[model samples]
Target chain A: MVYTSERHSHRGSRGRGSRGRRRRHPEPPRERTGGDIARGIVRGFGELLFTAGLLMLFFAAYEVYGKQFETDREQDQLAQGLEDQWEQQEVRGPDSEPLPGSANSRLYIPDLDLQWVVVNGVSQEDIRYSPGHYGDDAVSGGDATAAGQPGNYAVAGHRTPGIFWDLDLLENGDQIVVEDAENFYTYEVIEERTVTPDQVEVVDPDPFNAENNEDPQRSLLTLTTCAPRLNNTHRLIIHAELTDTRPKDEGMPENIADMAPETQAAAGE
Target chain B: MYGLIWRVLPGPWPVKLLLTLVLVAAVAAGLWFYVFPAIDPYMPFNDGAVEVEGG
Candidate 1:
C-alpha cells in the first residue's frame, strides 16, 4: 500500500483521490446457488415442527391432568357400580327382571324432602346431585364404603344454596336415608370439619377408627362441598355413622317409586 | 447428501428458498388431506362430551 499526499485533484477534491489510491478487493459479490436456498427452508420447517410438538404436549397434559381428571370421575364410578351390581344379582324377582321403581338406589331425608339417587358414582353426569357442579374423573366419592359400600358407603354432594335445591339445606345430624334392594340404611351425621383440598386422607376408606384408630367398623358416610358456600378454597366435610339398617320395605317413603326412570335400563325391568 | 445441500446454498439463495417452501407445503398438505381424516375419529373429538358427564 502506498501513502498518498493530501494534494487536491481535478476530479473534485482530496477525498476522491484518497479513495482512488486505496486498493479494492472485489470478489463477484459472493457465490449464489439453489441448494443454499433449500436448506434455509428445511431449517424453517424443522423449527415449525418442533414448535408444533411442544404445543401438542401442552394440550395432552391439559386434557389428562386439568380437564378430564376433574369431570370424568363419574364414568369410573359407573363402570365400577355396574360391575358390583351385576355380580350381586343372585336373586330373581317374579318377572325375572330387576325390580322397577326401586330407586335404582334411594336417598331419603327425614328432615327434608331430599331423597335422590346415590347414582352409582359421582361423575360429570351426576352434577345434579351436587348442586349441578360436575367433577372431573379423578375425584372419587372420597369415602365410597362409608357412603354405602357393602358395609359402609360414602356419598358427596354440592352445598351451594339454591343450587342443589335439597342438599344445600343439609344440617348437622340431618339423616340421609339410603335405600338399596334389601334394606334402607339410616346414617346419622356424627362429625363435620373443614379441610384443605390436598388433605385427601380425611376421605380414605378408613380415615378414622377406634381400634387402631385406623381400622374402621361402623358404616361411615361422608359428604363434601366447596367450603364457604360458593368458593372452592376448602372442602366442608360432613361425617355420618350408620345408626340402623331396616328392610327397604319399612323405610322407603310412600312417595318414592320402586324404580326411577334413570335406572330403568340398568335395573333390566 | 448433506454436503450437497450446503454446497447449493453457497451457490444461490433465492432458488433454494423457493424449493424449501415447496417441499414443506407438499409434505404438510399430503399428511393433512390424505392421512389425517382417516384417523380423525380416534382423536378426542367427542361430540357427546357435553352430555355424557363423568360416566
Candidate 2:
C-alpha cells in the first residue's frame, strides 16, 4: 500500500512542474525576412506622408482663418489706443513728428465701408497688425505728409480679408477719408493701376514725376497693396486727391455718414 | 503608429487618453505661436508691403 501511494504522489508532482514550465516559457520569435522588412519600410513611409499631409492642411486653415482672428483682435486694441491717445492732450501736431510704429490716424473707406487705425511705419513688423503709413524709412525714400498737408499721404496694408481685400472695388470719385484728432480729410479716388514692385515713384510726393523732390503742389493720398491678392508679382496702387476738409466737431464726413452700417455689413457678407 | 504608442504607454486607459490630449494641445500651441509666425515672412500673402530690395 505504501509503495503504490508514493508512486502516485511522484507522478502528480511531475505533471504539475511540467505544466508550470510550459506556462513560463513562450515560443521563440520568428526571424524577419527581406520581404517583411520591405513591407515594414513601405508602411512607415506611408504613415510619414499621411502625417505631413495633415500638417499642411492644418497650416493652410490657420493662415486663412486664424490670421483673420488675430488681425481683428489687434485692430480693436489699436482703435481703442488711438481714442485714448486723442483724449490725452494732443498726440499729433502740424510740426510734431510721431514715433515710428505709433498710431497716427484713422483711415475710412466709405465705398468699401472699412476703417482702420493707420500706424506710422510700413515695415513687416509695423504693418503686421494694421495698415501702416509710408515714411522716409519706406523703399521710396519719401516721407508721407500729415493728413491734410500738401504732399503724399501713402499707406500700405495686407490684402487679407479684414484689410485691403476689397480695395479693387474702389473706383474713380470714391471717397477715402482720413481723420486726425482735429479734422476729417476726404480724398476722391483719381486713378487705380497696377505697377511693378520697383515702381516706388507711386508713393512719391509727385506720382508722375519721381525726380521732383519739392513739396507736392496738391494734397494726395496713395494706397498700395500686393496685386492678385495671393501673389506678390506686382503692386496695386490707388491715387486720390484731397477734396474736402472739415472739423470733427462738424460731425462725420458726408459720404461716410451716408453709409448705413447694416447695409455695409450686408454688402460685406 | 498611434496604436503602437497606445499599447506602449504605461498607464490605464484614462491616463493614456489624458496624456494624448495634452500632447495634441502642445503641438497646436507650438505651431500657432512659434512655427507659423517664424515662417510668416517667407509667405507670399504676408508680403503685401512693397520694398525695393528683396521684399
- Tens digits of lDDT, candidate 2, A1-269: 89656655544454534353454334231334344477788988898899899888888877778788888778777776776556542635445656677777888998787888888888788788788888765635445577788878888988777888899999999999998888999999999999988888888887876666475688889999888887888888999999999998888777888654632343233
> Best candidate, TM-score-wise?
2
Worst 10 residues of 2 chain A by lDDT: A24-33
- What does candidate 2's lDDT look like per residue over B1-55, in tens digits? 7667788877999999998898889998899878986887788767756643422
Q: Against the true structure, whose DockQ is highest?
A: 2
Best candidate, lDDT-wise? 2
Candidate 2: lDDT over CA atoms?
A: 0.77
- List where candidate 2 sits over 4 angstroms from the true fold: A1-30, A84-93, A139-143, A211-213, A258-269, B10-22, B52-55
Docking class of 2: acceptable
TM-scores for all candidates: the values are 0.41, 0.78
User: Against the native chain B, what TM-score does each candidate's chain B reach?
Assistant: 0.54, 0.72
Error of 1 at A20 (Å): 68
